[model samples]
Target: MQVAARGPAALTSGRQRPCRPACAGLWPAPTGLSARCRATAEVEADSAVAGWEEREERGTRFVAGPAFYRPESCAGRDLAVLAAALQRKRTGRLRVLDVMAASGMRGARYLLQADADEVWCNDLAPDAAMHSTMTYNLCTAAAAHAEAANAAPGTDPAAANSHASNASTNGGSSDHSAGSSAAGGGPVAADGPAGAEGAAARRQAAAAWEARARVVRLEGLTRDVCEWDFPPLPPASPDPEAGVKAETIASSGTLGAQPSDEGAGTSQPTSSSPGASAEGRTEERPGPEGSAQAGPGPGSSAGDAAAPVRRVRITHADANRLLTNCFMREDYYDLVDVDSFGSETQFLPAAIDAVRFGGLLYLTSTDGFTSSGKRPERALAAYGCYPRATPWANEQGLRMLIGAAVREAAARGVVLRPVFSLYSYHGPVFRVMLRATSSAEWESRHYGFLGHCFVHGDNYTLGWRSLAGAVCRCDSRGKLRKSEEEPQQAPADASASAVEGSAATEPEPSASPDEVKAPGPSGAPTPTSTPAPTPLVVAGPMWTGPLHDAAELRAMAAEAERRGWTGTGLPKSAEPGGNRAKSSRNSRPLQELLQLLIEEADPRLAPGFISVDDSLSRRLARPPPRDALIEALREEGFAAARCHLESRAIRTNACMEDVLTVAEQRLGIKRRR
Candidate 1:
């Protein structure tokens, strides 16, 4: 109830309670805190909304004090950790940089779970309170890593929590020093004074701020989380202009617009852990033979359990500045994870630039509305392509995001292929893991426009240069209406057989060479009139390729099982049969989701999917059985697979006509009375 009273100031003021504070200084606030934040603040768990507290994920503990952390969205994190671990195995080393690391959870896990050699965790906070909270978590995470590394073989991994407990209870070494800098400071000079003295003061202050940040990086404590070197506030003066100009120092914080969050992911954290489970999981990473090293390079490894210690540095800067600095310095990271609130389009170029050759870029987008065609103009501005509503809009959201990155990389003569793409309903979040590649297809056919025809409930993918003279065959409300001349109607009784016959008899629709030719037969210079237009709700220049890299998904699933995150890492049953196959083994949501995504990678399936409950599927007398329909699809030699974006939907190559036919004959879907 006191949220309005507390606002952003509460977390920044040391004297005030740790009521939820906005990290506004971390980024600029042209308007104010986001609506998603407001709604989340309203319904947050009673334990969390009040302030700093401990939370556990993937066997690592971190504090959630000033930044927002939702347990529901941890599915994305689970996959990332798996990928980072794989990267380490492939390259023999992994260095990570996590930007916007509010609670430092992801970065901490990178060190503990992925066994990275080093991790730079950043949340460049704008105020003292948020900074201190983040510092506490980072220090505790590092210390926990140290203890876990030193713990000998055959010891219970859960016993490792005691070390972090001691660190927090002991006051983290510099609590008083940190508090004094933030809670008690002399009035800062508001405006630049005349001449040399003022200039010298500003330089001294900037130098001191740098020194402070550097120390915090090395030692991980005593950080107050304010702007580096700049005056914390607009100044203790009445000059509004001075305040406005003062913002230039931290301008990188607001480099991009406020991103849309995954509204679905913000549900109150109720259960101990909603989507993640620890059935076969352990907190320990054993070394070769039996003895584990506590440090990397010479000693322990950077993995879950008390494997070893890795170099970890905590930073508080906007994402762009951090990545850009790396780019300029040619100091690239093995993995760069940017978990921004909304569309990650703004950071694509810079993110690509900062990654070492062949490294991965894990991107996210929560603007489900934009991809669903609610904001075409905004989508264009962000992804360099427009989004139009379609039956598979959720999947299009993934394609839209990938297409943008592909193009961005193409501009630099590089290619990126999806290691895996995830669409979690929790936040309606769209996440994609892309890796630089060679021998992968990025030609025009793989990146083109997609069209959905309302007239026939059909979808098409066409190249940008080939849109001319294209026509929808069902323009006349007739299947494959090959000629303009109206034809005789068929009897009602034969319609069923006719419906099922097109799969074998008629060819799929395409630009008719005869109709598309100019008026003269000899290829005249110009044509007098053109064929009638067929309207299509179109979305484009997006990735029309496979959603997941089959090899990568398989490896991740195997890794999940090896790490005890899942039991089999395989679905209990996903057979293309009549009965719905059971999901993954109990308490393994990550495995279940991964299996569904794996199914979506079939090359035979096209760029669209149909909801099992939509009118197309209802064309049968009864709602068709999902597995039976999939089996029917394959029996007729058509491709079919379930899409993870929606539970009851399938992506297949067979046209709707064949689907209805197979439903009628194989699935026992009777014709309507």
Candidate 2:
């Protein structure tokens, strides 16, 4: 509050209290500051409201359904991730069955994002399944809500009745039936009979024992939580006074049609990390603030559930059997993921069989493929696979060792076309991406490892070759000498020709600095020795896993050993001296490398360093020696430079018996339920 003040000019003129002289560029507004402040506030409010409206419209379109209820069953973004991947592949209207659909979040999200012909969410846990069912029901209810909102104030009675009836038919009950009916069609038909029969049998058994065997199937419009016993929605509520008003706003018009975030203010910081330059350089710049909001918690909202689906199924089953059956029946899948929890040595054949002749299969694991320790043939004998040595480089050797299975598939007329392959972030998991198009393209991609390098490109290296004539027969342009072969010529020319041929055929010896003739001080050229060609080790195709038969395994084993292409239990240094010297020369910190592998493969295998205990058993179970640890990691197929430090230290710890206590979890290996 202020009293009425005198004019600034009057004060400055010394008519009242002596005020300091006004500063340059300072001017009072004719209407006063209060009005300006009010105007600014109003404008800000308008902008905020407009932004929110825009977000609401976009979000409404992107996220479908009544997801406010059953957030747990509705949330978890895995479905979105899967859906996005499928969309990129241009797959649509998939028939999906989430066998172990925990709360059905993944399936629900798929429905929201992709146009799925059918989605069947099944879970052994009744409560979780019912909660998921509620999510589906709410989605239908929301559609009805929209329709009711749009109805005119006064409409014809018959028209209204017919509309209502149609809505009822299109409601919850109809949705489920439609899903089931749609699922009954499509590629899913193959698995449906087996799955549905099993489910029905189980249901029958439960009904036989229980006195009350009532099954409550809800309509799409109204959720029957009481009958199904679904989980309750979150208890927290939004602020009533601060609720958002529903109003249309202008779109931000992003190219990808991404929704605008209304709650985010202009002052908020952006969420994306600074992008790297083409050459990987970073350009730093300050950004805005308060842009990102905390995402909804996992298992929280059904809005994520509507979308189309692609065809691919993952299950805990023996790959050998699964693939054989599918193959025998001429049933093929576009792709198969064989990263089981344990050893997949016996399942290679199944993978090959299940995948179409030209389909693709992704195999990952942390055992035989990593090192030479497990004889490729012997390790895969249980399933029947083999490998052939063509040629390979040192680094290429490591990569091939982990990707042995993919290579083996190629050997069996399953063309191993790599689309994308990458080393696992956590451990020795080797991810090999291969495409198998129907039968015609089923051939192995030949990879050669020789000298100190691995060549992945398509070309074979010819072993050391000798030219007919060595010395000066032709110039650098590869010209042939015109000299004719004289049967009766003197031996001198012959000897000279032999020498030249030998010189050309044999690799030129590495020249010492002193041996090189320097150019004259003015402008003469210097003469340098021709460098010797680096030696190369050829590797053929390799079959390391059982391809549905024992005979195949035996063949693979014999071939792997004969060619020295087998995975060594541990990696042996190519250079002189043992593991320790190699570690230093390779710039591979043994401890760090091992640590990183274990963390990626299974961190829980070795938790943390513990003090040596007094127990006799503990004393006897000292950690493996450093050399042994190095050998172990190398055997597992980890790059020498990639193992982490903690793993190495733990391996040699006094109390270390084993690093991987959780042996039950190996990627691509089958595990028990």
What would the per-residue lDDT of candidate 2 be over residues 233-252, giving only the tens digit for each residue?
11112212111110110021
Cα lDDT tens digits for candidate 1, 210-302: 233322111112232221111011011122322232233114221111111111011111122222212101011011110011112111111
RMSD of 2: 31.2
Q: How well does candidate 2 match the true structure in TM-score terms? A: 0.30
Q: Highest lDDT: give the candidate number.
A: 1
Stretches of candidate 2 off by over 4 Å are 1-317, 342-345, 356-359, 372-413, 439-673
Candidate 2 residue-wise lDDT at 279 = 14
TM-score against truth, every candidate: 0.62, 0.30
Query: What ranges in model 1 sit over 4 Å off?
Result: 1-50, 153-309, 438-443, 474-534, 567-588, 671-673
lDDT scores in order:
0.51, 0.26
Q: Which candidate has the top score in TM-score?
A: 1
